[model samples]
Target: MLNLLSNLICTALLSAPVVSEPANPKALPFEVSAYVTSENKIRVAVEKSAPESVVVLLRNSKNEILFQEMISKKELKYAAKLDMKNLTDGAYELEFKSAQGAIRKQVNVATKPVAEPARVILMNTPAE
Candidate 1:
């Protein structure tokens, strides 16, 4: 029974029609992601299966580049930690570029408000 099932599966797979490829590929050659950490820092990660030159940039709201780095083709996996302590709180942008295409990510940094403690009053005279 196992041998017959294996033969049937192989025959079905072989008889399946082959789909034509699209004129323009929708997927990018590399995968990239970025996010802001609780410690006021931005973390960027990239993964490219093939060797390719890549560039990473961090820009402010004014479109001014605050940080930039060039990654060699030999490095398949890339990770970066951007320190935003010195920079003022505002909207920022992170971009990853390669020969195939480019991708952009928005990063916002805003300080959280601190909550004030509640006030308490004592009534010692009434108790006495």
Candidate 2:
């Protein structure tokens, strides 16, 4: 009887399931995303759960406004391509504000230097 009771308790513990808490308990109603494209440009996208007014701004390291736009509430989705060709190599900030909340992202611009090809010389007088 003692061996049978121990076996039943071990089986119950092994068959139990484990539960874990989620990383983010609360969910946001809106989503924002930005990325750099191949043509030296930034692509901004925003999706909202409901139609609401949103303000988007792009500022430089000095907090100077480079570009600003107000999205109308009538639009549910928004996408834009910001030109970065004329921008200097530095830090920039992108901000989005709406009724749900606000979000900010930092971007760094840099240019790679080009390397020159090496030169080679040949001498044929020593062959005689």
TM-scores for all candidates?
0.69, 0.70
Best by TM-score: 2
Positional deviation of 37 in candidate 1, in angstroms?
2.4
Model 2, TM vs. native: 0.70
Per-residue alpha-carbon lDDT of candidate 2 for residues 7-89, written as tens digits (9 for 90 to 100): 22221001111112222213444567787766667788988777789888888899999999998888889999987767777
- Superposition error at 59 for model 2 (Å): 0.5
RMSD to the hidden true structure, all candidates? 19.3, 22.0
lDDT of candidate 1 vs native? 0.66
The global C-alpha lDDT for each of the candidates, from Candidate 1 onward, is 0.66, 0.67
Q: Give the 10-residue window scoring lowest on summed lDDT in candidate 1.
A: 11-20
